[model samples]
Target: MTASGDGEPRPFLVAASLSGAADADWARAAAPHVDAAVLGGVALDPVSRAAARDLVARGRSEFLPDDPICWIDRGFAALADAPVRPGVNVRSATLEPVREAAAVCADRDAVCEVNAHCRQPELRAVGCGESLLREPDRLADYVAAAAETGATTSVKVRAEVPGVDLVAVADAVAEAGAEWFHVDAMDSERVVAEVTGDTAQPRADLTVIANNGVRGRRTLAEYAAHGADAVSVGRPTERPAELARVAEAVRAWREGELPAGEPPDRSEASP
Candidate 1:
């Protein structure tokens, strides 16, 4: 139910993106409950791979293997028959790997998501992840490189970063040809509205997906009220019941069964 009978995007969607755990098998298992699934968050290139290894040494979650291009190809190959829209969330310090990965995504008609949401010290120290938030021009360059490959490009960002203006970052990436803007709203769900509701220069073509603390009907309603085009589940993505609940809530909201003013509830929010 990710799209209409004519193959257009659905009114609302349940998306899931796993850091180190996402693979073809995970995507297949979760595909039944989600409309779209982003895989990997894989580290591409020498610098990013080195950063991933450091994170691994520190017991942080990250996808491994030195050959990330082959990994992206193989992962997408295994998901050729999957029902959900497949995407790869990637980390790279330079444009070469991003172009390489986005080329692979273009070949498969998949999404190439730039990782600007990771806040780990190791990732930031290497100019990957959240470090891009502080350098919007660099982040936009990554998005532009990905877009140049003819793949659907997305940028995953976070709010409440000390000196970063999330809306300006959104505009920069959007101007660089990003089709999707995935916002990890953290504790500021209203930021979704701000990004989507930018009246100065509306980004009508950018699809804004709200993440963090999204669980069931309550959170879903809250995000929708804040103008999020869709919602994504992160840490709780492996829980089938939780995915099912969120999917059901999406369906309810689409069908007008979920109230717009449903009280905010963070009891079941994911980390």
Candidate 2:
């Protein structure tokens, strides 16, 4: 899990949320500031790709390209010149499509994230995103298939999906051998902490990345205290000042200067 000899975890990541085709462009500009950039929420298979293309055609999508392969490839090229690690966040329902996308990521030596977080009706209708929450078996199979490709496999989960046992969901993903579990902690940081604590105490092999509403170094430290390996910024990255502040915080934290709260007791980490 350590990317270096010192056994230090990698710096905080910028979770996947760069829209469409222009994700590469955004990553190029943001690369110097973050440790990694996940280039997409890109649709890979023909059905999802068609939906993305249709959105672009209808002027509904600002940064997506009409051609699926071109869209992904262009983003890849953008990351090639980036100053940080490049990753791709892909949305798909079936294992074959994810395998195809994972192959592309493997070719580029980039991370491939399985998106189970998108809430778009169009995506849900196609059995992606929140839809997968109800189908843990399928989700496990999907991540397992992606991992078999030998690309770094990650799964983005929405922490509070209705009626879904997210902890169980995470266990299934980990059991399937996903190296990273990216949690979109929608209004519930405690849930993220619970998941992180559970994964850490027995076997901290899975890298738990806490996402959503992480605004500053304090919040970053807070998540760390909760056992997250890292915290991520999403909408806040749209603000330059906020992004700069977060970057500085990450630097300080990495250098062992950012003040962090005492790690939370795992018993209190219950969701």
The prediction achieving the highest lDDT against the true structure is 1
Identify the runs in model 2 with alpha carbons over 4 angstroms from their true place.
Answer: 1-9, 50-66, 199-203, 262-271
Counting clashing residue pairs in each candidate, in order, gives: 0, 1
Q: Tell me the tens digit of each residue's lDDT in model 1 across 146-225.
A: 99999988899989999999989999998898988899997888899999886554366788888888788888888889
C-alpha lDDT score of every prediction, in listed order? 0.84, 0.72
TM-score of each: 0.94, 0.85
C-alpha RMSD of candidate 1: 2.3
> Lowest-lDDT window of 10 residues in candidate 1?
1-10
* Candidate 1 accuracy as TM-score: 0.94
| Superposition TM-score, candidate 2 onto the true structure | 0.85
lDDT per residue (tens digit) for residues 1-271 in model 2? 3452112246566645656443767777677667777777878776776555666776656344466556666678767766766677887755697887777777777778888888877778888878888899999998888888887888888987889988888888888868788888886778876786664432357777888766666767777667777767766556667677778877776777766675433332212
Error of 1 at 8 (Å): 5.6
Clash pairs of candidate 2? 21-63
Worst 10 residues of 2 by lDDT: 262-271
